[model samples]
Target: MTAAKKIAASESKARAAEFPAKAGEPAVEVEERSTDGADGTRHVKEFVVLKATWPGRDEADSHKANGAAVANEAIQRGLHPRGEPRFDGAEDHPDGLSLTLTYSVDTVPSSVDHTPGDTTTPRDVLRSEG
Candidate 1:
């Protein structure tokens, strides 16, 4: 299979029947997105958005920064990110955006369902720069 196809296949396997999350569990999605970088290079990535939240309503800068931290930490753990972190427009939460991590194309999620290769505190809402 080609790179894109391989990504799609892996993503489908991860989402087979893990839906309608439990009462308090955050929803997840398998994202296979590509974006062009400032240097003109293209990034092809596939990963899982384990969990997300709108943490900085009315504070655009804070939310984006916080998202960046989470994505960055995920990157350090061998996972890939779509591109530079930014706030995607949302309907339910007008003032904030989602923050999430990612995974390798062939990464099979662990039973624990935590960020891969990470053992540090969560930075999904870290105020300061990492």
Candidate 2:
């Protein structure tokens, strides 16, 4: 069976719970940023980006599958998939397709910065920054 069919809901939830928000971890958020234009005008755009390190193989695989599901759902919603598959560095398994999915959230740079003295801090950052 395919990876999607093989993984059950409980198994996925268990895997996800392993990576809970620690006392000090980046908070993932979705927001829009102003894009500067050549003519000096700006436009707001929304994006999804995330940077997380999985602790083990199972967690990594779980994360990858989760990302693929999101992408596939987006495709179903009419968002065109961009670019060719960059599976060159992906691991191969004897079973079905074995791949990892990495996703990024495109937020305003100011939204992610955690440096001291910054005025705008995300809720997660503020909770842990002190």
TM-score of each: 0.26, 0.23
Q: How many backbone clashes does candidate 1 have?
A: 0
Candidate 1: misplaced stretches above 4 Å?
A: 1-58, 93-130
Worst 10 residues of 2 by lDDT: 36-45
Candidate 2 residue lDDT tens string, 72-94: 43233222222211111233333
Give the C-alpha lDDT of model 1. Answer: 0.35
Instruction: Summarize candidate 1's per-residue lDDT along 28-86 as a digit string, tens digits.
Output: 22222222111111122222222253343545564555455545544443334443444
List the global CA lDDT of all models.
0.35, 0.28
For model 1 the TM-score comes to: 0.26
Worst 10 residues of 1 by lDDT: 33-42
Top lDDT model: 1
